[model samples]
Structures are given as C-alpha cells and as structure tokens.
Target: MYTANNIADFFLGRYAAEGKITPMKLIKLVYIAHGWYLGLTGKALIDENPEAWKYGPVIPSVYHSYKHFKNSPIRCEHDSEVTTGSEIIDKFLDRIWKVYGKYTGTQLSAKTHMPGTPWDITWNDLKDRNRSSLQILETDIKEHYQQLASKNANG
Candidate 1:
C-alpha cells in the first residue's frame, strides 16, 4: 500500500536530485501515464474527469487521429499505420520510473492495476479507501499538498 506521505517523499527526492519539479507536475505526469494506460486498455479511471483526458492520456491518440484525418490529402498514411494503439497503453510500472528517473534508498511502487482508478471507482469504494470523512480523492490530494508545504519548509 502506498501512502500519500511516501509518494510526496518519493517525488520530492526525485526532483531534488534532478531539477525543479512541482508536485502538481509530478502528479500530472503520473496521471498522464496512468490515464493513457487505462484509456487504451479498456481499464477505468478512478476519476473520469473527461476534461483531463483531453490533456494527457488521450492527447497523443487524439493528436494522431486529427492529424491523420486533417492531413489525409497530403499524407499517404491510413489509420492502421498510425494506430499502434496498444503502444499507448500504460506500461505503468516502467514508465513511472522513466518519468521520475531512478531512486536510491527506497524502492517505491504503485498498484497501477488496482481495483479501480479515479474514474472506474465507485462512490462507495472511494469512501472506503480514503475514509468516509472526505467525499473525494481530491481531498486527500489537498492534504498531501499541505504536508508537502510543511516538509519543504522544515527541510
């Protein structure tokens, strides 16, 4: 099981050893990788905010589709040529490391194949997973932000 604290530490350490990376950026990267995986593989997201799909997970395919159709006159390629569709699937385990790079002290892993991502998850599951006190996962994300702020200040 991955706690938010461990995730914060993992991201902070990764960015510290490399270059400047905001927590939001880190989250977005992870979200993108995970999102792309789910969309292509017919898996689901914990949060199906269709808006997010426009930016990350579905962006590359959508881009390819638009280009294929729009440039059909000039370009001599068909849908099959551009559709290495599964390539867009989430090799979540590997890509996480690639985006964040290497880690030395602690070996961190996420259950990308967990029962339901933000989109696929139900209200009951969300309440049970994060404690019913909060209505949504964003609440936990907000708390993580506060914790990151305090940690950065102290260290």
Candidate 2:
C-alpha cells in the first residue's frame, strides 16, 4: 500500500521529468492508477480518498501539493524514496504509465467524466446539493474497473 503522495510523486518522477505535466493530468493519472490497482488486485494503491471535484476525481492532498502549478506543467525534483520497494507495485506503475500516460489532461478528464463512472456518479449525486465535496467510493471504483478488465479479458 502507498500513500497518495507516494503515487503522485511516482507519476511526477516519471512524467514531470519532461516538464509537461499539469496538476490536473497528474491527479487523473493517480486516480486511474488507483482504479486499475483495485481492479487488478482487489486492493487500493493509496490510502488517501478521492473526492469528485468539478474537474474529476481528485485526491485533496495531491491537489494541494501540485495545485501551485495550476494549469501549467508542473516542475519538480524527482525523489526515489517515494517508491514502496515492491517490484509488483513498480511493474504496475510502469504498466499504468504505458497505457494511460500518453493522454493529455483533458483527455484523461474526459475519460473520468464518462457517464456512470465513479466521478460521474459521485458528481451527479451531489451536484444539486450545497456540498463542496463528494467522495468517490472505493467499492464503486473497484467494481467499475474490474468490470472493464473483465470485458477486456473476455473480448
């Protein structure tokens, strides 16, 4: 298990090296990775909970950490200590980058905002309320992506 910061740092270390990653993109990648981890292993990759923000699912800690970048590409010094020292986790992160890292922040946001997605469900559930935050349940994420994995495996 990793902290959300650990996963965020992992992505920053890999993708931000090019200095082309915005906070929005980084957050989305972290959320996507978390979803896939749950789908693949029935476990969460990070302990921090994600809230369905107007943009998409966001880990508040990570959002604050990188929010300074705003819509600009983030600049950071990579830290190796963020890793969990697990080969399995490293491999899964690599796969996540390979599969989803190529997309722009807008593209990733579109994916997360798709109808019936965890973000979508949470957002819809709370859109009319005066609430400032809506939690995207881990169970919903796991089940949704697990079904996606199943479909991919079958077809």
Candidate 3:
C-alpha cells in the first residue's frame, strides 16, 4: 500500500537534489512503477485480461500512468482531444508540484525549472497504440495519492 505521495514526500526530503524537480519526477515515476507493479502482480485496473501481463513491460503500464495524471486535481476543464495526450504530462506535473509546495509550505520550485524532464514519450510507446491510453496512467497516479491521504488520515 505504499502510495506515490508517501514515497514522493520521503524522496523530496532526501533524494531530490532540487526539491521541485524531485517530487515532480518522483510522482511521475511512482505511477510508472505502480503500473509495472500492477502488471507483475496481475492487479491492473485498466485492462481485464491475463494477457495484460504481457503488455506490462511497456504498453499497459504507461497507459495506466498517463490516466492517473489526466484525472488529477489540477486537470483542466478544457478536455480537448488535442493537447490531451502525452502533451499534458508536463502541465500535469507542474500543477501537482505547485500543490505539493502549497501543502508543505516549502519553496519547492524556487530553484527548479518547468517542463523539467520530458516524460518524452508517445502513445506508440503504450498500449492499444492510442494516445487515449494516457488517461489510464493519469488516473492511476491520482488514485495512488488519494490512497496516501486516506492512509495518513487514518494513521
């Protein structure tokens, strides 16, 4: 039940060379890692098939990661088919990093740059060979953080 935010908060305090980029990239990496974990553990909520295990190495995991970002709290109201795919990853991470800063009261972005590291990936790199699969990854990350919040509240 290790959540993205949990790992991210810890990483940001430690491994993050630059506070802002560390959490931003870690958030993205968490979703990627979760997708891979789901694939390996046969726990993917995105697809319904045993063969999903095969897609884990690349396709399914990436798609799930993108979906989590798309559904994040910072999601734009304008949902255009255009600029809604991998193009939004940069923006997605930006908004989340800002929120993280607000919550922590830390000047996380003071020394960081925007559009930090291009996830630099395309839909072709994910499943169904479609850009829409990006949504899956975005959704997964959002849920991961939500889980973190819930766990902390209870604990």
Candidate 4:
C-alpha cells in the first residue's frame, strides 16, 4: 500500500511538474483519488486517514508537509519515482488525473462538500458542537463513491 507521502509526491510530481499547486488543491485531489480507489477497487490507495476540515477533506500529513507554501502554489524539486512497484496503482493515478485533474481547488472543494458526501456527513455531525475537525471515515467514502460509480454506469 502507498503511504500518504508517496501519493502526495506522485501528485505533486505530476501536477507541479511545470507549474505549482496549492496545498488545498493537492490535499483535495489526493482525498478524491483515495475515495475513487476505494470505490473502484474496494481497496485504499493510501493508509492515511482524512479529516473533514472546514475547507474540505484533508489528509493531515500531506497538509503539514506542504503547509509552508501557504496560499502559494507548491513547486516540486524533482520527479519522484513511485516505488510501490504496482502498475495498477500507477494506472489508477493516471486515471485520477485524467478524470479529476481539470478542476481547480475551489471546484474540488465544492465537490467534496456536496450534500450527502462523506465530508458533509462528518462535518455536519461535528459542526453543531463547534468542533474543528472530524474524521471522514473510509467506509463512508467507499460507499459514497461506489454509489457514484454505479450512477455513472447506469446513466
């Protein structure tokens, strides 16, 4: 299995190859990729847990790793090879980029915050008590994205 850093590095290398990316967008994209991986393959892409933050779903480790960029676009120093040795994962990451890479950070955040989403459920449940963060359960993400896949298939 890939760790969050490995996945983050993969995305940063891909998206930030020529340009830069904000931490908010990178984290959201990683969260989306993880959810889709769970939905499609019934497996996790990474081992890290995501929290429903006020902004959207966030992987804390990824956030901390790139937090120094603040609102600036994060630039990578070099391309990092995915050492997971899984062609399947490499393909899935490519697919994730093709499918979801077009959206901006705000757009992805909107998608994650949509009604009935895992982040929505978790955020709503915790927002009442003024909580700052709530765990967005993997089960919830899997179920939600599974339904989305089914919907897209049926349509």
The best candidate by TM-score is: 2
Per-residue alpha-carbon lDDT of candidate 1 for residues 1-155, written as tens digits (9 for 90 to 100):
22223232343443434433333344444444434434434343333222222122222322332343332222222232221123332234335547444422111123221234342242335445664422224433334334444675799
Could you give the candidate ranking by lDDT, starting with the highest?
2, 4, 3, 1
TM-scores vs. true structure, each candidate: 0.27, 0.90, 0.27, 0.90
The lowest-lDDT stretch of 10 consecutive residues in candidate 3 is 111-120
Give candidates' CA RMSD values in order: 16.3, 2.5, 15.4, 2.5
Per-residue lDDT over 46-137 for candidate 3, one digit per residue giving the tens place of the 0 to 100 score: 33211112222123333343345542332222222222123343344344445443332123222121121112122234443455434334
Show where candidate 1 strays beyond 4 Å.
1-16, 45-93, 96-155
In model 4, which runs have C-alpha deviations exceeding 4 angstroms? 80-83, 127-133
Q: Clashing pairs in model 4?
A: none
Ordered from best to worst TM-score, the candidate numbers read 2, 4, 3, 1
Clashing pairs in model 2, backbone N/Cα/C closer than 3 A: none
- What's the lDDT for candidate 2? 0.86
lDDT of each: 0.35, 0.86, 0.35, 0.83
Q: What is candidate 2's lDDT per residue for 1-155, written digit by digit as tens?
A: 78888888887876677547788889898999999999889998899888988888998998998898889998888873446578788888878888888898899999999998998888987756555658888888999899899999999
What is the per-residue lDDT of model 4 for residues 20-114, given as tens digits with 9 covering 90 to 100? 56888889888988999999889988899899888889999999999999978887774655434677788888788788777777888999999
